[model samples]
Target: MRLNPLGDFIDDDTFALLQQHRLFDAKSVRDFQIRKTYREMRKKMTASDALDKLQELHPYLQYDTIRKIVYMSKAS
Candidate 1:
């Protein structure tokens, strides 16, 4: 599969850069970054703070989606 296929709902720049690489697909890259970012944010901020920061950085990101991912991961 193409790592940075056209349907991953990521920023264009990120997709373009990933498309340039040959090793990882978009899913791998996105999952890796999400975990990394979530871990770091947890170390320094409450979930509310992290959500605020993410909104500031990416206004399009829905907090609901992030909240679901966090809780679902914990449940698993």
Candidate 2:
């Protein structure tokens, strides 16, 4: 069986919001270019240049958020 990616962190309100948006119980976020883009960013960019490059690669993706999610999930 599949569980939520955020699992217990997903409270009733967030679940309801997802359901209301016709999205429910998803386990993974799709279409992120983290590995590919971050690698390239690492190649030519320093910290100051990262955000601009990342935005070019993915406008909607927030690096810190994804990092936190993956980091927390994997740490457990």
- Write down the lDDT of every candidate, Cα atoms only: 0.62, 0.53
Question: TM-score, each model?
Answer: 0.50, 0.36
16-65 per-residue lDDT for model 2 (tens digits) = 67867978433344322344345566678774476556556556757775
Q: What's the true lDDT of residue 37 in model 2? A: 49
TM-score of 1: 0.50
Clashing pairs in 1: 3-25, 3-26
What are the per-residue Cα lDDT tens digits for candidate 1 across 1-76? 4444444477767767766785456554554455556778989999888767765654665778665544555443
Residue 57 of model 1, lDDT score: 59
Give the candidate number with the greatest TM-score.
Answer: 1
